[model samples]
Target chain A: MLTSAQLDKPIVDSDLQREIEHFLSYEAHLLDTNQLEAWDSLFTEDGMYWIPLEHGQEDPVGMVSIAYEDAILRDVRIRRLAERHAWSQQPPTISTHQVTNAIVTAHDPTAGTLTVRSRFQVVEWRKRNFLRHLAGGYVHDLIKIGEQWRIKLKRVDLVNCDGVHDNFELFV
Target chain B: MAEADPNWVERLVEPARVHKAVYTDQRVYDLEMERIFGQAWVFVGHESQVKEHGDCWSTMIGKEPVVMTRDSKGDIHVLYNRCPHKGAKLTAEGCTKHKPMFRCPYHAWMFRMDGSLVSVPHRHGYDGTSFDPDDPQFSMTPVARVENYRGFVFCSLSEEGPDLKTFLGGAITSMDNFVDRAPDGEIEVAGGVQRVMQRSNWKIFFENLNDTGHPIATHESSFLAARKTSKHKLGGEVPFQLHIIEGNGEAPEFWESLDLRAFDYGHSFMTAIFHAPKGKISEDYKAALDTAKGKEEADRIVSMNRHNTIIYPSCSPHTGFHQLRVIRPISINRTMVEIFTFNLKGTSEEYWQRTITYSNIVNSPSSTVMVDDVEVYERCQEGMESDGMDWISQHRGEGRDNLLDREIQSEGISEMPIRNQFRAWSHYMLGTPASIPTGGGDS
Candidate 1:
């Protein structure tokens, strides 16, 4: 039985797939380019950005999550990065995200959105010591606009989800 | 190098500040292992971690490998993770038991749940010798003292000292209200732990818990970044992330208005700048509380809002989120912080999500907010190693402290908490009047 509280499975049509690809690429471009201003456009007014601590974290309230960002926290991260005294970024962390394995798993027609999964390996070069690996699965919930799509929620599941991560300033 | 200086312990501590060598020096670190870690009531895992008869979690109190486990009779035990013979680690990390027995990997020596010697492979061979299984030397050595306050367990190696309740003193309200805030008056260790490695001394993190001055200067970048991101993303309408950032930029007057209480035994909790708010989360939780308990009791529970409560050198408990950050000093230069989230028993799903949400955004290792804070602590550490500086100042609003019985209250921006901690540190280092206060509360 499909209850009102139940979320419909997202549909992945060819055009929708193309739209998602464009949306993801745009989001990635904004992050890599340090264009946080434009990157913020992806989320809705009260949209959420969550990264689960474990593989399948059921609830964010009772359990600890790796990263939970509403609009404000995401903004703070962006602002901090752009600040002149972001000492950690004195030698800015250069990065190129190879977002691949783009597969549209489900679509919710009533909600006008779809759930897409992709494998991403973000190789970030910092300081001159070594490149850090941020290999993770990206779960994107995309909403349709007039002619484009916007991100409702983006959950990144890092391969090393529980490892001692240095600093994750850039959005995955 | 030269078998360590005997007088090094005496010279390591002073009233105001200790030398940087205390942090960076390996000699001092070893002595600290003996004096502090070897003797103090170090925190073991929470009771909920070992709910089942055989569940266990491995932890370190200074340089010792201690395993916290639950016995078959529902009693929790903290035992040294070693075999009586041949000296082998009894169990691996996160080991489970069939019943309540632990067998050593090397030599088949079995131990009971309460850390008593159970079996020996060559018992007949040693029958003629002075080998007795009942002897304390042959048995798995349990710690000298183990006590559980609320659901969290704490163990001390020293046979003589004040009990856990006395040692906790005025700051125990943090732990008490942590469980009391739950509708059913109980909390369970839920979710997983997030571990972060800090390249600074353990004291650095401890001091940062009550540090009000650093947020603006140290975390300015991250919070500022969060603000800009939120503003641009949400069309200048801020949410939780931005709220966290904006908290850092609170006026001096705002911070000064909040109370910072320092209790006996280096424990304390700061008044919240933003704790219980008129937000949807708090409102929903209040409703849940009203349903379970009366409105007055619920109001009282929520009103006891706090930021972080430092339980000395071990962990900091966030009463609001049902979370604890256990600080483990691995080396003089390296420290590991483990965050454990908990669930309020009999609370609605909304209440639990708030805790999880707080952990994800604030406590996580890769948190956008905490990364900058971590960086600056490392910066303080690196800078302290130079020959250029001697003392890190703690003279901020020092003399104007409000002393009420055993609890000292200071302005939020005051460094009284830091000085108060150093007083306890000096007492521990000098081994002066070496007795923890007895009775339930300090005051």
Candidate 2:
């Protein structure tokens, strides 16, 4: 089971809190503006983007998931979205993600790693008529390399994770 | 029983094309729900899903609520998921494990796993009424017929029809090969299920299963992305992950080289375009298979590789990938697809993991490949609403199908499968027997 990082202590450092909040907002901004390539760049080389189908899904392998993608799979999706004949994206799905309630549960100063949990609600509009409302919880495992914090894992647990869904053309 | 138009269905479905009403009209959809899905042996849950006594798995057989349950005697039965008194569903949707007995939340009516009425809350209230506890009407009703072929259970609403084996006809080989690949000669439904909703008619999705002509055009975006990623990042050696995607970019000649076989009852399958991945995990899996069922038998089982085997309007099983996609038609313009990945028993954990990877990459709604297919299906549904055309064409390779005793073989890119499906559709809707139509290539 992939659990959240240990809760070392509540982040009392104002500077560290501000940096984490900025990073979360910027990530949401990239997704909202359809800057997928830039969003992809925010991840580490071996990072994973996972959306578990089960509520408390422990293993991404040996079980089915909505998504359990590595860098190559993520890049393939990004490249396909750029294709002119990508039929699903003909009109393009426009989304606005509202991410809030970010709580830094754990911060390892020595290893430069942090585990942050946030809540998000995304409204996606497509085909000029269909509007989908999706809400989920996000868990990010961030690791700092040099000066920048890169995502080692981004786990999304949707409220309706076990329900039927339409094709998700874009990342949530 | 009376005919509304007498010729309403026959006029719509011809040898080469079908009227747009078949895909768009609500009347046609209603008729199909009653005729085709009502009579055909539809796939219910597998036996493994309801292995324990009192375990129940709920699903629909053409919008009819039904549940598959294992009784105390170890026999599995398919029953209508409704309360005998109030007509409310017996169990909630999906699987409910170890359900001691079905206690209806509606009226507190209880039933055994075999659907026999056990007790009711107000037992003394029906003293003088026609509600005889010993009568069959008081119990949950089982479907007319239930058959389990190698643990894959199927149900038919109508009592009279060809048996499951006969209905499957030449397509039975696909199911046989599916179970034979298991090291222990058994496979079970495992992992989890992913459901995808498509805003299109159910037939459109079925037609696309063997429509070899579409991949090169429909899936160009995904295949091209896979190629670019392989070339730049993976040093031109496509891994199994990208190999499945890039395989869609095969040359036109490659698709034509495939062997396409269409059976009676709208069933068909295409020989796999993907070669077995040459990797350590796969090698170990093959060795295990060889050990279980002698080397020669294992070789024969592995050699029968296939991509999509359509068991007609219900499910499509990919024998090579260990995936089964169940098709559920929600309404006229809406369809729900549930994908299930199987675990071949006695295989390594890594072998099962590969199945999970394949499902996540190819069958999930979030798949880069299926999104395009779903989009085009929706486009066809929307375009059929246009008054520009009356008929959708299936003229490719029309006169070139090879006639056989029970099945037809055609070129991979041929539209024979679509035509064959309409042939079955006309039979079901027109109330004709499912015996091969005179001109439909069956001798």
What i-RMS does each candidate reach, in Å?
2.3, 0.6
lDDT of 1: 0.77
Q: Which candidate should be chosen as best, given TM-score against the real structure?
A: 2
lDDT (tens digit, per residue) of candidate 2 on B114-172: 99989987778988988888899999999999999998899999988889999898999
> In candidate 2, which residue pairs clash?
none
Clashes of each: 30, 0
Q: Give the per-residue Cα lDDT of candidate 1 at A99.
A: 84
Error of 2 at A46 (Å): 0.9
Per-candidate Cα lDDT values, in order, are 0.77, 0.90
> What does fnat come to for each candidate?
0.76, 0.84
lDDT at position B207, candidate 1? 91
The DockQ scores of all candidates, in the order shown, are: 0.47, 0.86
DockQ, cand. 2: 0.86
